[model samples]
Target: MCQTRTVGEFAVSAGDYSAVVVSQGAGLREVRHAGRLLTESPPVRPDEKPPLSAGLVLAPWPNRTADGRFVFDGVEHHLDITEKDRNNANHGFVRTVEWSLYDATERSVTLGVPIGRHPGWPFDLTLVVDYTVDAATGLTVTSTVTNSGDVRAPFALGFHTFVRAGDAPVDDCTLTLSAAKTLPLDPERQLPQGDPVPVDDTDGDFRSGRALAGVWLDTPFTDFADTDGRHVTTLTDPDGRATELWTDTGFRWAQVFTADPDHDQGFPGRGRAVAVEPMTAPPNALASGDDLIVLEPGQTWSGEWGLRHRDSAA
Candidate 1:
């Protein structure tokens, strides 16, 4: 049986939101919107858990590399092969670890986890994740990592959120991303090879709002517009309800995935969900040295991302 714990609650003029942090692997239990469910949590089917939400932090790395080995500081390091497809470790350490609750209040909750040196990653680090919700903004999550070891630590961070636009089928939804470049990948291993290509004249473009129905994407994109120091992306449904995602400067890349596990629904698509991921680095950062983030000893790094809903017709 799954266990659940209430962490915090925020009341807004639009509606009320609540946070539930679970003890089972310290996963986010729930993130409700206006008393309505905005995120799926506990009792979630196995397949529904991959796109974590209500703000969870992915550390050490974000996406996959061809192999589990990389060279750092003249040393070749091998990471545990977590993703069998490319024989690489995807994401970071905290996904499977249990976090300790550091603080909790009516509107926010803070949790912490320590990443210790191991065979895959030999760095001692401390990570903290804080989640909040506002009436104006649906949910905001912030994360900070501190290098507690003597040596400098190399890593990256990101969040994976699967958005469901009310009763709208994904095929009818429109995606708007202000990204200029899309990373080209090796067909066989799905690893980054050539330089990033412009979204124009390619199936990767979403700048002009594309319908999600016929779109298939599993690509990494960067060169996003720095909207006066803010980075934002939006997904709108036919009903005029929109889900907006905003992140900080450190998040330079975004990955959009559309999968349809239910084909019998006559949707003509795979899974009817849109995952808007925010990452500090691109895929295979450890090997490409493109998404690498260095943390000096005793130094801490922190950033925030959030989701807000708007009813244009209202």
Candidate 2:
């Protein structure tokens, strides 16, 4: 049996797509397109959490590190080993915590959580994630994080969204991204170990359309520039139907991942879907402090990203 929850004009299709919309707000939630799922949703089973699909916000930090430790303010901070293979904490809090629906209407709903100081992260902050849908457009998400601690806090944000071309297998789909450089990683643990490299002639290059069927990716790319600072990354099926992801200037890094059967849903012909991740910082920014955004006491940071459907004709 399927469970449904309604909050004002927003409808949550639980177990299928935990999407929320504010008919009044400029956002959409749990949106499905073509016969394939677009955003990640919470799991229906009592024991299973939401799958890392659809749209998930990662903050304070994104990606992984060589070790589970980073140095901040001359103090060594160690994070929980969320990914044992790399021995680093990937993403941030709230992947498990159920978000509070603070505001809901016909078109949008606001979900929020506060990250208190902990062993790994010793900064106090309040984070809010807003998911909205516009009938004329598709899904739009906005994330805001404010520093509530006494001291300045260094952080970054990212959204992990797994996308597929409707019923098409990943191999048959093509990917196009507007990036010039990519961060190289250590193969064994998949951690950044050196300087950024040009994406030319490498598997990391998506400047030109590339088939993703059998490719394995866990890399971060940079150098995405646009006139209005809103660049796009797209995935298109052989038939030409496509999904386009747009991000603002705050998002300088984009990580693309192709899952293997051992770790993903193992969809018959499609081992896993393609992920168009918009990140504010590169991997391991806590230690390197490169491209890290620091918020002064009582300061706030906000940004938006979204997905739009494009037809072959356009």
Candidate 3:
């Protein structure tokens, strides 16, 4: 079999912080603070895909679209099935498509791609992603999507990046989120099985934080508890050092996972591994019309999310 060839790799840094990003899918490969890892160093090959979707920008639609089917404006549409075993359309097509690296700087880089009408996806769209590193704030990612088609187009966004606090194992760390409800997913397809249920005592609860020791979560969370409208999720090691993933109002939904060995698929690292996915809409949004974002011709949608690390001051 022919292997994939990745190109246009770039690096940016500021004040002892740095990141490596690639042009293929404009995916982020690594993030570090003071030369220590703040995110998982996904073992991506020279020309292979990033396993477990690590450090990739998911767009157009994130997660699974059951059976690759959805209806828009009274018209039925079918997406190309990528997740064959589940017979669903996964992570949109852009994750493996090439994006133009339009601009770059000592501390930032910008890339874009234009998508035209396809069998399953009918609208014309353009996506621009900007990765910026701030000396005091770490890495910030901004995504702007526009509908260039004549008719109204629908889509949602999600980012897949695994976080770590210092060099601690995820099992020795704590995962925290300020979400009120959890979207119950079926054990088989990993698709929502019903309306969201309160997380008060459920396994998905991470509000006040919980040890990730043996927890297994492949769930989407919503109804956020935010700080000044900013929703933040944190992974803290035993020593109080922390790495955070924060999103602006645009991302009202999030997906969290505990990469249990049985369900880990290909997530990197040993011990409990975790992924905190910020999504603009819930999984299968296209099929359910749940929190889907629609854009008219020339309309643009934008959102911001970032990764930053804080060292224990003690």
| Candidate 3: tens digits of C-alpha lDDT, residues 35-109 | 889888777652356767778878789999999999999999999888899888888878887789778888898
Candidate 1 C-alpha RMSD relative to the actual structure: 4.2
For model 1 the local lDDT of residue 146 reads 93
Name the regions of candidate 2 deviating beyond 4 angstroms.
Answer: 1-29, 34-36, 40-47, 52-54, 262-270
Whole-model lDDT, candidate 1?
0.70
lDDT (tens digit, per residue) of candidate 2 on 25-122: 11232466533545433333322243443345676687775576888788888888888866878787655555555776455567677777767788
Candidate 1: regions farther than 4 A off: 1-15, 23-26, 40-42, 45-56, 262-270
Candidates ranked by lDDT, best first? 3, 2, 1
TM-score of each model, in listed order? 0.87, 0.86, 0.95
How high is the CA lDDT of each candidate model?
0.70, 0.71, 0.85
Q: Per model, how many backbone clashes are there?
A: 5, 19, 1
Q: How displaced is residue 170 in candidate 2, in Å?
A: 1.3
Q: Which has the higher lDDT value, candidate number 1 or candidate number 3?
A: 3
lDDT of 1 at 301: 90
User: With candidate 3 superimposed using the best TM-score fit, by how many Å does residue 162's alpha carbon deviate from the native?
Assistant: 0.7
